[model samples]
Target: MRRRPPSREELDDYIRTRLALIGIDLSVLPEDDPDAPADQLRVLRSARRVLEQTVPALSDYSLDPQEVPPSMYPAHLPAVRQVAMEEGRPAPAAGGSGRPEEDAP
Candidate 1:
């Protein structure tokens, strides 16, 4: 028989425990702050990056919704989803290098 996939509650507990081990306090997060969505996106992206960079074995653990059940996951799903959506868009190029324009001399 095939091994059953972990339930969302199990996954959430695992994630929370792991975050605690590394000093991240999910309980203190301000879920109602106006900028909470953006902040959550940043945190999730940063965590994903750190895990991928430091533990190559976990690089395969993408946060795609299909992998995570919607019911038992964190309440900030919309924010995390937004982060996933913006993953690879290019940033605007820097202007005129770092030097002052010739007219400024």
Candidate 2:
């Protein structure tokens, strides 16, 4: 016997629980209401726009949509954060001397 994937409602509940853990409560959004406020509509649109722009870049860099961890973001990956800490200072730029020009004197 094979395991079944969670239903959409289950996934939504999981996401909402995670959000609530971090002080977000989406209950204020009017569910399927035709008379929802313009400000609310704009917020939803802008959020979608940001996700549209973000998802492709994240996927291009080897992230999967369903693999999104509740507490994670693109730059917040463990390896990336670790590398920053280990560097202790910023990395040198490519083909550029490791110091600012004119101020090196």
Candidate 3:
């Protein structure tokens, strides 16, 4: 029997579902935690990379969640979302001008 490949949409849905399990909240942490942003970004990047790299190798036999070996799921999604949220917010200027640096500099 031949195996079918998992569709891109399926992969994306799986990723999102797994990510949701970890509680994707971004507003609670301090912005200056030097390691948080990078760690989250790494996880998000890894998830994307894994999907891109592994999806091509998957056959119909591999498409089934039960048959497919379990990999780390969304261990980093929350972290990534948190960091991204923080980064998205406007940080106060270094001089405390109440304006963002883009305006000052």
Task: Estimate every model's Cα lDDT from 0 to 1.
Answer: 0.50, 0.48, 0.47
* TM-score for each candidate, following the candidate numbering: 0.31, 0.32, 0.29
* Candidates in descending TM-score order: 2, 1, 3
TM-score of 3: 0.29
Q: Please tell me which model should have the higher lDDT, number 2 or number 3.
A: 2
Per-residue lDDT tens digits for candidate 3, residues 13-86, read: 66667867897642344434556754443454457668766653442122222234356453343455456558
Question: Candidate 1 or 2, higher lDDT?
Answer: 1
Model 1 reaches what TM-score against the true structure? Answer: 0.31
- Local accuracy of candidate 1 as per-residue lDDT tens digits, 56-80: 4343333444345546765464455
Local lDDT at 4 for model 3 = 62
Q: Which stretches of candidate 3 lie over 4 Å from their true place?
A: 1-17, 21-38, 60-105
The candidate scoring highest on lDDT is 1
lDDT of 3: 0.47
RMSD of 3: 24.7
